[model samples]
Target chain A: MKKVFAREEYCLGCKLCEVYCVTSHSRSKDVVKAHKSEEITPAVIIESGENLSFALQCRHCDDAPCVRACITGAMQKDPETGIVKYDENKCVGCWTCIMTCPYGAVKRDEYNRNIISKCDLCSETGEPACAANCPNNALVYKEQEEEGE
Target chain B: MSLSLKNPEFLIERNYDRCINCQVCERQCANDSHYYDEEMDKMLSKDENCVNCQRCVTLCPANALSIRQYPLEYRKNSNWTGEMINNIYKQAESGGVLLTGMGNPTPKKIYWDHILLNASQVTNPSIDPLREPMELKTFLGRKPGKLEFDENGNPFPLPPQLELDTPIMFSAMSFGSISINACRSLARAATASGIMYNTGEGGLHQDLYQYKENTIVQVASGRFGVHQEYLEAGAAIEIKIGQGAKPGIGGHLPGEKVGDEVSRTRMIPLGTDALSPAPHHDIYSIEDLRQLIYALKEATDYTKPVSVKISAVHNVAAIATGIATAGADIISIDGYRGGTGAAPTLIRDNVGIPIELALAAVDERLRREGLRDQVSLVIGGTIRNSADIVKAIALGADTVYIASAALIAMGCHMCQKCYTGKCNWGIATQQPDLVKRLNPEIGEERLKNLIRGWSLEIKEMLGGMGINAIESLRGNRLMLRGIDLNERELAVLGIKHAGE
Candidate 1:
């Protein structure tokens, strides 16, 4: 299992991770007015609660319920990286993942298009944009085998 | 009145009969004006996108191409005048400031043409570069007072150094101002050339880490993306005190241009204006400058040399002396006529002194004070050809940094509209669509070719002066003579007018 761990103590409140996440998902790289329009909604959220602030993103679980809850075969785990990914074409305006997830990782586009979006571990590049661009080095990706030993 | 001609298409015409196809036109054409069409089985011309640089026509092997105004007319402005009507239309299109790139291509007096080079006739014999081994290797960092060696016959206590296989170096241009591909091109070229390229105030990107040994990271006043790791990753750290394009004024990467990549690198929020403050808040005096200098040194563990770059201005001599004493390992002075991706027209047109005078004055002042050895000098701002490099070293500089020249090699038309963020050449655009146009592989090869060409010419120029090594020409004023210069100008340059 591959997971992302955040060091909240090192986070500088710069919100670059959220920006990179939003851009990585956006059709265009224009981040200035990315969230202003109704077409795209930010996949990652920067949440602050009682002196603790960190980015909230999808965690691609071992027994993922989002894949099971999807009535349409829109959500599935990739065989290569075991990453939970969403297929917008098969998404039939379902909110099952939004309600079933315990961590509230699923988010809808601003137009209320029932198709949900979340981080896919940036598996295509093997390095997440959020983790790569973090200036403070707060975010890290660790494999389960390496962590266990 | 007749209806204005709409959908007017402009195209270029080339005389292939006179075209030798020597690749000079192909090399200089930034827009791919002339290309050999494989399928068509002939050379094709696309002069419509030409920026009227005249480089292709000027350097053409057979003088085959000449850029002319399109015959298509919007209206018969026989009485109104084409230029006047064009100016009105320009004012209407963008009320915002007009920006451009490259050096001034206007028909101004180029000083190199007026100046003449000396030759060996009676007393000295001229060395042929074809026969003799000419050394053009230039070291940019501070040199030691004396070379140290150990008892075991090995070099010990090595002085701080940066070696350049050639004297040419890629000048400062932030990653945000240009594309990732453009920076990649420079990085690859610098690595291949055994020279250095500067990251102008932009934080180092992860992709450019492979070229870290050949990179010189710059720290300007804003300290936008500066961090501990960025500081330590460079061979040298350049403190940008001022830019020749817009002296005393700071730079502002507009919110629109601040994409996610630039925003992340700068450690600022996306879409917010990245303001580079004109002056460092902590540096109000020379003492404060010293403190920051030592602070950086301490942070880097004294491994990398620190260079302080300043625009040439009146009293630059005094400023240079102060910067040297402030513990800087190198001093880079930019003349007023330097090129910039985006600068206020008012600032670019006016401000500071020419490099020739500024370099001479600073060298004289430093030598008089016996502090010339304290720091190495690197001059820039309109160093066009290898002759300028030779003249600059003979005047006083140890090496020179070039940006516009390098860009020209990488297919920049010098259209001078870099501020608009729609650069056609992909050298000065932040937009992803435009940035993708430039291929780094081709761009790097072009930069390598330019440096190689300039290096050969510089070596030839040195050989013409009967100098075997570049060191022999450094501060050797006897080889240079000024023409059409008054006594005061001659005295300032510490050289005599022609026929003295």
Candidate 2:
């Protein structure tokens, strides 16, 4: 399955990915409206230092620990697409996946303390919002690494 | 010890309703103008710190920011404008010379706009550039006066030349003055576009060695990175006696900008100001210049063309003659309105002459003295576009160097805060984070695209004039006519007034 990838060298560290990620996940799907009204946290996290940065999301690992760690069946790896999908309804405000996930891709929703937020690759848009909105080609949704590497 | 009696130059207005407190503006501004207020639970701006680079405005996702010139009323007088009063306040506060970045921002006469190019009339047919082939290739070097063929109809050995597919080349902007990514952008673009990019006074970086075929290494007064391998690494060598921005003045790269890379490349100690003296100590006369030129030639084993770069000043024609007679293969004259990393405001605005007038005078003087073929004229100091390039060639320049335009291509917002080392667009800053803002890959693509667009326009203009080859327009003053120009101006430009 295609996954979102990040190249640290090209990352500008502007966090537009985070901004757009919140917007795409919001009901308005408008930058200004979503940012102003909605309190959805950005599923993608930007790890940045002095001159280096990379936008990170769920790896959707083959032996996904989030899938195994969930006490409730809210977090499940899609058998077809390989995305570690999150369901808000079934979540019991469990912090189990957030703890079990070694990559720290899972996070508590800022607006609501109970539920969790993570990358779903923006399934409706057919590509993740973080990769799509990156000003620089830092984040890219690709099937696999290029043929060379 | 003293309070500044100055007003904020710009006002940053943020729309509170649109602002989502994303803090992107706060993150992007290197000046620390934007900040998140914990007390207010919102984003706030410190307007005084803003240089009006628009990095925050451009990156503000919700379009919540806009900067405007602060409308501070200081009892406006025509003679003592706000600008003049502000300059006084700044000078009094700092007690130092006013330093500026980029080119002169004054409203001086632009000769390129005043002069007009000719198009083919009813008597001649203009070719369609899209349908027909056009030649823009240019060669910069000393000519053999006339071609000499051996008995077997083979030409004899020729002087070294820097062959370019276009008459446009990236002017010398040193690495210390601009980021290495900016340098890499020009280097990559020049290589891709089949043109040349100068290494300026700063030494060539190690990564740029791969593009040596398109490089013109420079030896300035400071001789900052001059060595055996450095000399041999270029397609040509340019001796930078003077720059157009701060003519008759030396260059100073502040210790703050001399990071490890710049320090190593320039062969200078870390954190020491790189000072290039006004005069080359040994070059006191034209003869002295000849010795240095020949010395560089000898050092390069006569394999590369040596160019002497000078500022276009009063009696520039006479100086060009001296430089040509001094055995330099190419003469590059930079006009006063040129860009620089940093220069005193007084020198930048008041010093050298315009390239149009200088190019015409020098070309006419060389032709009159029968020394025209001995050197090629490469001019810079504000060749803004394709029309400027065409007009420059018509006035006798073989090639035009573009620094400011190239910087603009690489996303320079022209904030003129380059000396502060906080260029938000990343063209002029050396700070690692800011430097990463301009990815050389993207920069190279943009620069190449700019050149590509300009080349097409140049060809179209050339075809409209019924000229196929760019060289055919060389010194063709009849192809140009001055509009709204007086007698002395027309005389200096070597062109007739409109309807003459």
- Per DockQ, the best of the predicted structures is 2
Interface RMSD of 1: 21.9
lDDT, candidate 2, B98-205, per-residue tens: 988989888999999999999998999998989999999999999997889999999988999999999999999999999999999999999999999999999999
CA lDDT scores, all candidates in order: 0.77, 0.91
Clashes of each: 4, 0
Give the per-residue lDDT of model 1 (tens digit) for B1-500. 24332221335567766543334455345466677766865567775556665655654434467776667565676677664465455556666654545444434444444455676876888889989999988776666667777898777765467788987788899988888889999999999998999999878888998899999999998897899989988999999998888778788888888898988888889999888888888888888889988889899998888999999889899999999889898999988888877776656776677788889999999899878887889999889898999888888889999998888887776667677676656678786545654667778998998889888988888888889899898888777888876778778777767776
RMSD of each: 14.6, 1.6
Candidate 2 residues lying further than 4 Å off, grouped into runs, are A147-149
Q: After aligning candidate 2 to the native by TM-score, how far in Å is the CA of A95 from where it should be?
A: 2.4
Q: A13-57 in candidate 2: lDDT tens per residue?
A: 889999999988889999999977768888988887777889888
DockQ of each: 0.01, 0.68
